[model samples]
Target: MAGQDDERGHDERGQDDERGEGDERGQGASAPATWRRFARERVAQRRFAARQLAELRGYAGRGLVAGTVAVHLVAGLAPVAFMLGTGLALRDLGSDAAIGWLALAAGAFLVQQLVAPVQLVLSRRVQRRVDAACIERLATFSLRGASLAGLERPEVADRLSQADEAFEQWTLTPGAAVEGALALTARYTQLVGSLVVLTWAAGPWAALAGALVAIIARLGQTEAFHRWGDVIRSLAPLRRRANYVRELATGTRAAKEIRTLGLVDWLDDRYVAENRAVLDTLWTRRRAVYGAPFVAYTVAALIGSVIGLLVVARADVDVAAVSVAVQALILCGRFGVIFPESDVKLVYGRGAWQALLELEDIARRTGPEPAAAAPGARLTPQRSVRLDDVRFGYTTDRAVLDGLDLDLPVGTSTALIGVNGAGKTTLVKLLTGMYTPQSGAVRIDGEDLRTLDVDAWQAAFAITFQDYLRYELPLRENVAMAAIAHRDDDEGIRAELERVGLGSLLAELPDGLDTPLTRALPGGRDLSGGQWQRLALARALFAVRHGASVLVLDEPTAQLDARGEAEFYDTFLELTRGVTSLVISHRFSTVRRADRIVVLDGGRVTEAGTHDELVATGGQYARMFDVQARRFADEAGAGSPDEPDDPFDHSAAAGAGATGGAR
Candidate 1:
């Protein structure tokens, strides 16, 4: 055993020698590397701190912030002074001079107590405002830029998550951190005074042990927390699922379906299961975070006990001096605990702040969409809107649209046809400037879409999507959302609703146009699915009435029955006549009346032309139409006469001019 121990020591020494030689050779490289790391860390800290201070300024005026600082300073310094005065008063109680020390001690304590209430009030107010102001600004910034590509980025998404969590609820905001920073001043003051007194009364070695314990405990906790970072990150998906389940159990939109489908108990069970999983994840990591600190504290307590024994054994120690030593050592131990807690708070809070700060920096780069035109830029499309050599995808691994090109002629009803996953919806977003392409030009008339003002660009078109929102607002507001610029046009709202065949819905409303649209609101009523679709149509037509020249209806009649869909298709031309309408429909019957039809396959234009032209070509479009026609015939009966190949019974003007479905 002795030989093995000696050999092990020798081996360690040899390894140390090798490391020493490597270190000496790399000393020049190592110094600069270490300094660079330190410099980067310091710079990051300074920058983040400055940002926090700047954010704080937005919530607190200069005078109030100054006053907060003053109170904090007074409170921080008071502790050490009071401790000194208390020690003196205790030691010199028999002397007249003790009265002065007692007075000083009493005054210091009283002053700190008096300032605390004001400091707390200011801190609370700052916390409220800072959280609100910071979250709102982040939201505004997040909603900017023409493309959603930034939000899709992993780094930006993570930052937004951090900021959102912080805003939701926090153990410490920037104001709390600031106040805690000042509290740190007080803790350190107590720490130093205790060390000075302990050293003078007992010995320096006792002070050293206290300091060592404090360092070890803080380092242990901080390291443990960081070590769990990867685990926390790994739980993101689980956390998201948990959050979804929680919302599902409580959300208003899902309430109807949950009750109808008997999903209430199932939803509650899922929510409970997810919450348990989340709890388990957090609980599993608790030991790693707490073990080291607990061990260090135990060691500190043992060392303190030894110090007390040594002081008692020394016959030369005066009783008054011994008391002072005990008091000081107690303060040292208290500081050891307090400092570690402060360090823990600093680590997690700073990390959260850094994430937000990093997001802000990233937003500065490749952001704010520089090509957005001035507010007054023309919105009316005079000629046509063109997607010029456009390419885009949600992720790098898969390209949704590859070199896709198309045109929408001014005042022409063009139908876009495609199978699922053909990048149809992506095209609509690109045209609307909700997403900017990785490379391409969406041109309006002659101007590139990127360079067009976002507001004006959106103003150019009125769109009703497959998943249109049913806003729980007043009936008027539901329609007025489209004509925001002319919301006060009550008569206009009534006319638009009438145009969409919803005049009957309005008459039945308890308060007519002023009636609320959701039962969630007082005296409100929800609309049926068909009624909601008509309402969405009303919103779109309202936009057209208020100067929107282009109309986009993506699966606009999805909720309507067969009769309603056929009826809508019959009148679709009259309803959108003279408007440059781009319609997307899975039901071939509805879009067969469009002036031109373009077929999309795997994100490229496979065919284009009139319905007749496409059918004559006998390509992808003709094959699709034939399949639908056969189905209708088969359903009616095999003995029945074959139905027309055309989906709609409209006149030749609507069906004759389709360009072609495939090349």
Candidate 2:
């Protein structure tokens, strides 16, 4: 147990090291250098705050921003105006002029009261506009990448997670930052106004002293909040884990598994433990960062207030002068103390804005750049889609596809057979240009795939992977998503659905093509697994109908039974007759019907031939086929002898053991 604790400590320290921190004890940088870094950070923070404020102003429109600013300015300066008016009123207490001064003071008070609600309403309007704009921009940035390769990177995922947490969990949105900036501006304006009033009522020396005190108190509070923000950011990983645990407990998708596995208590315990760890660390860090500073600022502020009041009391000043000086001093002290509305928003919302900027930077760096050729360049393949000695991997430690070469001839069907980890899916990704090979090339009709327009090239192929997404949308939208340009053609969509054997399912829906496919919505109904598979097939077929000549099916019928699988494969082969098709399936029964079969092993094609020819040679393909054949034979023999079943029947063995030789 001690060893485990030590290992955990080492791992945490390693993480801190990556963050460029010394250790948990905070014993790294020299004091002067640390102060310099802090100064630099403060400057950068101000610049980011300015940028966010400008963005908010743009999103909120000039009229709303101006109204909000006007409200806040009036509210901020009203106290100073009232103090001046009250002092004048006290100067001439018995005269009619004193009544006029009192009226001015009362008017200032009334104006402030009336504008307070206006400020709230305008600020909310600005926040809503900015929030909507930021969310829209985030969505756009997320989809800006042309290829899926960059999105697959771990760093991109981390940034995305941080961006999500910034918007959702922390509530430190760009909108909040803008509102905070506006409020903070008003606060500083009031502070300065109070000091100016002091200078007029007392003397310049007295006012200077008050300003120094306020600045010192504010600086300490700023440093404390900065440290607090750091602690919050460092705890993001823990918070994310807690969020995931909470989702598992509450979400419907994981409900069955959690109950069946009896993991409800375990999940609750995990969630509690993670949150407890986060709260405990937060409290510890809060005390360390805020305790001394808070005490010092309180003491300093008390001393300044007491000294200023004593000086005023000792002076031989008039009632009016004394009143104004005392009120101004109190106002200055109030402004010096930290305001949660502005300080918390500025500190945390700055971090949120920074996260968003980092996402934009990632988008710009990883998104596809313009190709040398026109982006509209069309791909009309005459020969084949080929991989030439391609070498690639998600990481440098091992290549998933190394020095591999294969070709899919146009207008011909090729079946790929391989073990589970033999790079079959990776090959399909390479062929579709979802990933680029580290060393070699993917060529279309002898032209390097990189030299062609990537978007146009990708749009030419219609692919259905093993794990197809089940969109909980209307049937028409779901099928038409593959060929959105032709979405208005409801008749064409219906025809494609009927072709994929979903005609009965379509006819059963009360809303026909408009019915949603998920039970989550009212009047919506979910389909069976086989029906969903057929819908996916229909989606791909819709793409093929609209100029997609290359059809790639990766375990497209994994959810179907033996007879259903056989029937679907036959229909698929017929529907995709003239298209270039690449079929990836574990079932040898379905693969035997392909025009050519390729056996992949050790990241390269080891055998390729007609099924009968490969069987005659007794290679890997032959061996896999024999294994399935024997499994089916055993199953046939186990049945009643009077049944007299044929083991080789495609429908009977279509759903044979998936791991027969593909283990």
Best by lDDT: 2
Q: What is the lDDT of residue 289 in candidate 1?
A: 58
lDDT of each: 0.70, 0.77
State, as a TM-score between 0 and 1, how close model 1 is to the true structure.
0.79
Q: Write the per-residue lDDT of candidate 1 for residues 1-663, one digit (tens) a residue.
A: 112233334446556655765675577557766555545544543454545545555565666666766776677667756776777787788999899988998999998899778877876665566556666656666765414656666666666676676556675444445445444555665567666776676677666755554454444444455445435645655776798788788888688899999998888888989989988977877675566656765676667556554653472556655766666656655543535424544444544554565565565454445354565343888889899888988878888888888999998999988888898889998888877788887899879876767767886788999899999889989998877767789999998888777888899999988899998889899999988998998899898887888999998877776655665677788878889999998767766789999998876788999988998999988898776665554544543355444435453222222212311
RMSD of each: 8.8, 6.0
Candidate 1 segments whose C-alpha is farther than 4 A from its true place = 1-64, 94-96, 153-159, 170-179, 189-234, 255-277, 297-325, 338-351, 358-378, 395-398, 511-514, 562-578, 630-663
| Candidate 2 minimal-lDDT segment of 10 residues | 1-10
